[model samples]
Target: MQSTRNKLIDLLANNQDKYISGQHLSEELNISRSAIWKHMKELEKDGYEIEARQRRGYRIISFPNKLSENTLKWGLETDWLGNTIIHKTSTTSTQHIAHHLAREGAKHGTIVIADEQTGGKGRMNRPWHSSKNQGIWTSLILRPEISPHQAPQLTLLTATVLADVIYKETNIRPYIKWPNDILIENKKLSGILTEMQAEQDRIQYIIIGIGMNVNQTIHELPDDLSEKATSLRIETGHQLDMIKLVQAILEQFERTYETYLNEGFKSIKTKWESYGFKIGERINVKTMNQQWEATFSGIAPDGGLLVENKHNGKVEKLYSAEIDWFRE
Candidate 1:
C-alpha cells in the first residue's frame, strides 16, 4: 500500500511545474476521482503542500525536496548506481532509513536522501555537519554477495570512485585519506561511510552514505569547520552544475563497484593505492593504545591498513584505529 501510494505521489510530483488536470490523472492512473482526492488528502497529511484550483485542477506547490528525485533519476546515464531514490525532508539518518528499507525488501541500487538530517551521525557517532540545502547528503543501498569479512575493502573502493568522479568532472584532483575521505590538498571535500548487514557467511546489504559539499562557500560552514571543510565550488572557484556532478559520481561509482564485484579487488586496490594517502611514505599514526611511526605500505586484502615499521623492520597490519596521518 505504501508503494502504491508513493507511486501516485511521484506521478504528481514529476509533473509539478505545471498543473495536472484531475481528469487526465484519473485516466492515466486508472482510478476514480474520489480515490484521487483521498490520495491527495493523504499526501497533504504526509507533509506535501499541494495547491488545487477550480479550473487549474491540482498543482504541487512544494515537494519536501528530500532524496532529490530529479538529480537521482537524471544521474543514471550509467548502468545501476541510483536506480531507485527514497527521500525525506528531515530524518534521524539516511543510513538508518536505508537500512530499514533494505530489510523491508528494497531493491539494489536504491538511494536514500535527505534535505536536512536532524540526527545526522558520522564516524564513531559524531555529529555530521550537514547544513540544509547546502550539501549532498545521501546513502546508497547495495546488496553485494560477498563475505562479511570482505566488507571494509568496499569503503576504499567507494572512496576511489568519488575522487575519480570529482577530478574527472570538476578537475579538482582530490586525494584520498586512507579509507574514505576525499581531500583537496589538505582540506576535506567529501566523506564516505559504509555500514554492512550480513550473516556469518553471506552478505545481506551495505548502506554507503556519501556527504559531498557542493555549492557551499566558506561562509556556509560554521566558524570551526570553515578552515577544515570545503566545497567543489570553493575549490574550483565556480558554481558547478549539481545535477551533472551527481550523475558523474553515480556513474563512476557504478562502474567501479561492478568491477570490484566481478573481478577481484585488484583493480580497485591498485587504483586506491595510487590515490591513497601516504603511499610509500613514512607517516605517523596513533592507535588507541600508543603512537608510532611507520612507512605506509598499502591496504591488505581484508581492508586492514598495512604499515611497515622502519625502526624495527617489522610489518604491522592494523584492523581498526584512529588514524591521524601526518601531513608534512
Candidate 2:
C-alpha cells in the first residue's frame, strides 16, 4: 500500500518542474480524486514543494534531502535493494531492528534505516557515533544461497561497493582498510559490520550494518573522535545531499552483489585491492598472543589479510588481527 504511494511520488517526480495533472495521476494510479489529493497534501507536509493549479494540476518544485521512504523511492533505480525501507527518526540501532525482522522472515533487500541511533555499535562492539540527521546508519538484509565459510566475502563486497560509491559521489579517494573500515587521509570515514546466521551447511540470513559519516563537521564529533573521525562534508568543504548518496549506494551495492553471486569474489577482490590501504607497507600487528612488524601484501582469496613477518620472512594469513598503521 505504501509502495503504491511511493510509486505515485516517483511518477510525479519523473516529470519534475513540469505539471502533472491530478486526473492523469488518478487514472494512472487507479485512485480517486480525493485519494490523490490526500497523498499530495501529505507530501507537501513532508517538505516537498508541490504547486497545484486548477487547470495545470500539480507540479513538484523540490524535494527534501531526508531519508524517508517517499524521498528515497523518488529516484531510486534498484530492483530490490532497499525497495522495502523501514525508517526511523531515532532508534536504538538499525542493526537490531533488521535482525528482528530477518528472524521474523523479512525478505531479502529489506533495509532498516535511522536518522539517529541511540545505541549504535560497530565491529568489536565499539560505539558508533551517529548524530541526528548527520550520517548514514542503515542495515541491509540478505538471504544468499551460500555456505557459512563464504560469508566473509559479503563484507568485502560491501567495502568495494561503498568505496566506488564514495568516489563517484564525492570524488574523494576512499581507501579500504583490511577488513571493513574505510579511511580518507588516514581518518576513519565509514565502517561496515556484517553478521550472519547459519546452520551446518545452509545459511539463514546476513545483516550488514553500514555507518557512513556524511554531513557532520569536525566540531560535531566528540573530543576523542575529533582526531580520528571525518565526514564527507568536512572532507569536501560543503554539505551533500544524503538522499543521492544513499540511492547511489543502493544501486551500486545491488549491482555488485548480483555480480558476486553470479560471477564470484575474484573480481570483487581485485577491485578491493585497487583501493587497499598501505599495500606493500610494513606495519605492526598484534593478535591475541603475538606481536610483530609485517609487510602487508594483499587480501587472501578467502578475504583474510596476507602479511610477511619481518623476523622470519614467512607470510601467514590473518583472519583477525589489530593493525597499527601509524607505527614508525
Candidate 3:
C-alpha cells in the first residue's frame, strides 16, 4: 500500500510546474486540509523544496539528494533488484546487517543500505572510512545456483556493474584494479567485498558489500587517507543524487547478472579487460612467499590474475597476490 506522503508526492510530481490546491488534495486523499499541510511540511523536512502559496497551494521546486527507500523506489526500473530495501540512518555496517538478514532467510535481491557506517570494513578487514552522509554503504543478498568455488565470479560481475554505472552517470571512465577495486587517476574511489556461506558444492547465500566515496571533500577525509583516497564529488567537482546512483547500479547489475547466468563469463571477462588497469604491463607482485616483477597478462576465465614469470618462460595464474602499482 502507498503511504499518503508518497501519494502526495505522486500528485505533485505529476502536476509539476503547476500548483496543486490543498483543498483538492485533502479531498482526493480523503484527509483534512491540516493533514495535507502536515505531510507537505514533512516532505520539506525530507529535503524537498516545495513552494507553498497562500491561495495557489503547493508546487515541487526540487528533490532531495537522499537515498531513502522511497527515493530509491521511485521510478526505479528492475524486476527483483531493490524490491526489499532495508534503509538505515546510521549503523555499524550494512554488511553486518545483511549477513544477519541473509542467515535468517532474507530473499534474493534484498538490499541493506545505510547513510553512515561507523564500523565499516573493506577487503582484508581494513578499516573503510565512511563519513556521515558522504558515501554509499550498501550490501546485497544473493542466492545463486552456482557452486561455492564459482562465487568469486560474482565479484567480477559486481566490478563491471559499478564501472558501467559510474561511467554512465558521471562520464568519467573508471579503471578496475583487478578483483574489485575501482580507481581513478590511481586513487581509490570504491571497494567491493563478497562474502558467501555455502555447504559442500551447493551455495546458500552471498552478501556483496560495496563502499564508495561519493561526496566527501578533501578535508572531510582522514589525513592518512587523503593522499590515497578520493570521492566522486572530488573527481566530478559536484555532488550527485544518491538515490539516482543507487537505482542505476541496481538496474545495471540486474541486467548484467541475467546475461552472466544465461550466457557465461566470456563477455564479462571482455568488459572487465576494457576497464582493467595496467594490463599487458610489467609490474611487481608480492605473494606470501615470493616477490618479483612479472609480465601482467590478463584475467583467467575463473577470475584470477594471469602473470608471466620474467626469469622463466612460464605463465601462472595468481588468485591471491598484491600488485605493486607504484613501481609500474
Model 3, 45: alpha-carbon shift in Å?
Answer: 5.9
Off by over 4 Å in 2: 1-3, 14-21, 53-56
Quote each prediction's TM-score: 0.79, 0.95, 0.88
Q: Residues 257-326, candidate 2, lDDT per residue (tens digit)?
A: 9998999889998999999998899888889998888998999988889999899999999888878684
Instruction: Estimate the Cα RMSD of every predicted model relative to the unseen true structure.
Output: 4.7, 1.9, 3.0
Question: lDDT by residue for model 3 over 1-328, one digit each (tens)?
Answer: 4657778888999999799999999988999999998888878877889999989999999988787877777777888988889999999999999999998999999999999999999888999988778888999999999989888889999999999999999999999987889998899999999999999999999999999999998889899999998989999999888888888999999999999999988889999999988898887888899899888888998888999888995999988887856362
Q: List the residue pairs that clash in candidate 1.
A: none
Q: Between candidates 1 and 2, which one is better according to lDDT?
A: 2
Query: What is model 2's C-alpha RMSD?
Result: 1.9
lDDT, candidate 1, 107-207, per-residue tens: 88988888777777777787778777767788999888888888888888889988888888877688888777888977888888889888899889999
Q: After superposition, how far is residue 225 of candidate 2 from its true place, in Å?
A: 0.6
Q: Over 4 Å off in model 1, which ranges? A: 1-67
- How do all the candidates rank in terms of lDDT, highest first? 2, 3, 1
Backbone clashes for every candidate come to 0, 0, 0
Candidate 3 Cα lDDT to native: 0.90
